[model samples]
Target: MSAKTIMIQGTASHVGKSVLVAALCRIFKQDGYRVAPFKSQNMALNSFVTRDGGEMGRAQVVQAEAAGLEPSVDMNPILLKPTGHASSQVVVLGKPVGNLSAMGYHTDYAPKALAIIEGALNRLLAANDMVVIEGAGSPAEVNLQEHEIVNMRIARMAQAPVLLVADIDKGGALASVVGTLELIAPDDRARVRGIIINKFRGDISLFQPAVKFLEEKTGKPVIGVVPYFQGFRVQEEDTIPEDRSRAELVEEQGWVDIAVVNLPHISNFTDFDPLEDEPDVRLRYVSKGSNLDEPDLIILPGSKNTIGDLAFLNRSGLAAQIVEFYRRGTPVIGICGGFQMLGRELNDPLHTESEIPRLDGLGLLDTSTTFAPEKITTQVEAEVAGSGLFLCETSDNRINGYEIHMGRTELAPDVRPAFTILVRSGEKVFFPDGAVSPDGLVFGTYIHGIFDSDSFRRRLINTLRRRKGLEPLQASDTLLVHEQRERDFDKLAAVVRSSLAMEKIYGLLGMEGPICHG
Candidate 1:
């Protein structure tokens, strides 16, 4: 039998579609159903490498974790990582096809992409007991409706009942719901089963008349009014609001201050989530060179366009600040594209990332990088190569992270290797990964999740504290990072269950009542 399916589409982008899908996935899995999440197309720089070496959006990875399943490329079939303002690098089935302009993708590639989407959807439906589908942006883009492959098109293909979600925190929640329903075609509008008011801040009791007005006007029930939740943690998918003012650089005071140089096309900023969880760390993203304050550490994050972002660093004067920080004995670390930028030179012979043939780097590491056509996407396990560094207390320390980059870095003869990767893509391998300067003040690596390990994080922080003549801190008593993630899933599921009308939702899925409160 085909699996039951439900689609959640937002009235606008960042309307809580990803979080709601994750909540439902957790709820269903707790109730003893094999659930999976699917998104036909995703456009973001945040991505993940599956166990089988396939690449997909990180949001689906979070949802898959909530569902107690391994992430699969079929969960996110098409990924569009923007390389330029007008063009994007398209990945179909976990590999890069090529870069295409927006017009070219819509005009020439939409049909083929639609076919790929349907094939993946069918396979997912056959395997799972239930599938929670999330839509991108909005379905009310009437101008792009004919070429739409993500929203209403997938809903019709799966025959899934739709729950339109609107953020009440943003004003015009009622108008957005009414406007979206009015814009879609009559038949497409009929598929919407109910409306969910998400991210509500004020007292819900005061909103009863508003909910009643919406129901009377649109003839659809307000199925839920989810309050604004602050502590719930989930991997966000390129939805960070741009209007919020950038944080000001502040004194460390009692905590270790960390500054991450915000690149032009910053990818995988979620790499710093673990640091945010640490109580003694104050992490901030600084975009301007003048904003670089004296901090315990400075990190150069991954970027979608390395050469372009490197040029941005040069033009914005942030490169000079980074060099000054290194000269002053402050620890500076780089990952992936950031690792490439820390080297002596970056060469793009075939214009893989940019038209620039060669560009000078920050000159912090004795290494050079060259862009290649093939991108590496794999999981890895590595051991610290030596002691007396930020990431390792002993040479036996093991760290796990994933590699996602297109450049091949070559180290100088005199530089010391940082970590020796023992496994790649679930296979045994022995190879050096990164470089460390002689002074131990600068390093660069391709690993993304190196800080998630408690032992490594504690050692690094305590080492910095000792440098400042401060006492060492106690190791975290909280759960391990992965276990904390599981608990967070349960917390989100509880909030969703209490707020949403599950009886109506189950009825729409053709399931009988006495819904399991999992």
Candidate 2:
């Protein structure tokens, strides 16, 4: 019941802290330990709903999967979802408290949040053999140290050894590490047992000198210099890396082409990670002002701000382009906020999302949505109830995914329901979700991660293939995305274990003996 713990603290945001924690979680699990991933607080737009209908960051969800455990809100007690420039919707233990300004959160919420974090940490420690804690931003932010609930605060509370990580690819890796160590308090600095240089792209031999410099500068062992990795696909914790440039979105060779409209406040884009991994689909993320290409399918992805982003689509002319694509027989599917946008109108009387009281939707589906204070965050099992392009082969229309939204949609009598909700948050339920046009061309659903359902995803792509005069692909060699993710966990663990000083890691965890994996 007494769990050994290690914390991965990064020099700054997006320095690969989340990925490193995931790798260690997998390594510990492979070493025959009951490992769990924990973060006292997480600030991210990409989120996942647990079975109990509690919402938490997807990074912890990935780490939980790597540790071979189901995600729980206790793994992440506090979640900060940014709603605007100065405000965030604070969620404690997987439920929303309110949208509070940064100052208000520090003054009113931090004291109470620390207790919640302590309770969650104790629960995880009691249940697991080991727990991997991840820090947010920098512990060196002196201005927020008094109110900080993540980073050194949690590390000290958990009495965990800290592995300070720096992104060598960002230049001045040594400086960042030294500067961080200098800024944090002496006791917090003492907690840092080692240093890790992440995202090193160049020759490893050339970087050896700098690693030595960091170790000498901070008096901490340079645990590893992880080279920039590829091939294995995992979810990026927060926003897409700005430097992660892609080639032209149109590959011009795939049977079923899909272009996802990337909105300004895009959330849960990980929903399409499965589609991007599929060899048969040529997927692209089309930005708001980017030139549109005629693809077989156009997807309106989930947005954090339904009213605000819909206004952006209309003002930016992407809405017109989407209508044109739909008119020319290109199929369209909207998800979450996107689904709300496809409706006839959206009303926000309570200002739950934004100041706009009402805004006109794309009118693709004969439905209307109204924003409510009650946000629905639940996992669902649904079956296709209406005939549509994606539902052409209805022999197997059962699909499961999670929903996180605040609006409720009501379909018109003429439009058919898209899906029938069979189960919600692990309970029996009967309700209609989304709507389909009479012609069965355009449809919208609030379900995120719907494409993760292998059979349903394959059917969608195979139907597109038939429409394009290509033969329907048989589902003989279908592999579930979750299975592939398990393989990825092992692949990542192997890479990191080879790069890092795993023996020292075990020593730091107060354990010994090299474990073998089959």
Candidate 3:
């Protein structure tokens, strides 16, 4: 049988294209069809390394889980990490090739970009019974329509029927969908097979008229109106700052409140997931305009654009608020770019190279960060600070995580050292990497996945509980929640496998029955 394909295109970014593709992949895989998720390109810092040493966007990683498969770099060929206003770090087929300005990327690399995308498609073609391709941004961006590698062009190249998706929650989704279809060239529009109205909050019955109108006018079927469910298990495609989680609203049960500053370009916030798994603690991701009045602890998460986001934080008054929190004896921690922001000064004078200029840091820690042309990327282990108020309460808990950044930092003489010089490779440990104040209440680290360790996470969470006069939750209870969450996802995939029209979908994917468990 020939490979059949389906594509999910969006009217704009964050419009539920990734989630729709994930659901479809799950449903098709359940019907005994081997399925895989594909995206020609993605612009995100949330990335994961596959077991086979391949890299793919985190969205595809989640979709791969939904499809009962491991992630692969071939699933997402080109990854563009926007580092500044106009500059982006480009990854070609999972490896860092170079950095490019927006115009430079499109004008100089379009031909080669297409070649790499086609190469990734070829890999997906070899592995799966069917493939689901996800489009990037909007298909209707006419200026970018010509050299598009992640949208209709890739769909046409793969010969997949596109499923257009728009978020009803965004308002005027009908017009957005219709307008997107109308704006695209005739050939591109012809590839659309159906449409799905995503994130419908109210009764689906009320939208029947609009759905029918769209189907009638566009001559395309309305496949589904997926309602928003509170417990849905899917990896987020972008940094959604909205207070959508039911888990966040639950009372802490006298547990500690750990508020993490939600930066504009927060990367790998997953570092805090283990802590969220703890039942006795409340992990509140506070976005802009939210009060930081009484957070027992405030965590500054990693950011893709440090200087630019720090500028955002300073302008939004979060910087001053952080200082106030520190003065109040509240534990404030920064990770990666957040660590950089806590320094005395940040020097990025080459405004021609990026958006951030040499700006003053929060100045909580006596340290400074300087940007380098090359990024530091590695996995390592470190021992926590031996002499800090925060460390005094902790036992021997080792930290393990990867570091990815393009800056060098050193502590000022007034501050006590955080982590001792245990190990440093990748050449020249210019300075003692992570920084800690003499008291340990204020600290920063370059590590990305430190909280993945249950013991370390519990120590931090329990500290907050101690400060808040709350009861402590046992570690076993917290891990169980995550186990249940994963099991629920597997169940979700099973449901999709059973309910969808499998045979037709399978036929479209160019695969016959008897899907491999692998």
Which structure among the candidates has the greatest lDDT?
2
- Candidate numbers sorted by TM-score from highest down: 2, 1, 3
Q: How close is every model to the real structure, measured as TM-score?
A: 0.95, 0.96, 0.85
Query: Judged by TM-score relative to the true structure, which candidate is superior, 1 or 3?
Result: 1
User: Tens-digit lDDT track for model 2 on 1-518?
Assistant: 39999999999998999999999999888888889999998999899999999999999999999998999999999999888787889999999988999999987888788888999999999999989999999999989999999999899899999999999787878889999999999999999999999988978998778778877888999999898888777688986533222343334433577888888788898998887776666777888667777688999988878899999999999999999888889889999998999999999999998889999999999999999998899999999887867765467778998999999999888888888899997889998988888878898998888899898888888878888887666666444798889889899999999999988988898999346574
Q: What TM-score should be assigned to candidate 3?
A: 0.85
Stretches of candidate 3 exceeding 4 Å from the true structure: 1-4, 27-34, 48-56, 68-70, 205-211, 244-252, 273-280, 285-289, 349-357, 379-400, 412-433, 479-485, 491-500, 512-518
Q: Rate the local accuracy (lDDT) of all candidates.
A: 0.87, 0.88, 0.75
Compose the digit string of candidate 1's lDDT tens values, residues 79-98.
99999888989999888899
In candidate 3, position 13 carries an lDDT of: 90
Clashes (backbone N, CA, C under 3 Å), per candidate, total: 0, 0, 6
Looking at model 3, which ten-residue stretch has the lowest summed lDDT?
A: 421-430
Model 2 TM-score on a 0 to 1 scale:
0.96
Model 3: per-residue Cα lDDT over 142-226, one tens digit each: 9998777789889888988887888888798899889999999898898887787777788767888998899898998777676
Task: Arrange candidates, best lDDT first.
Answer: 2, 1, 3
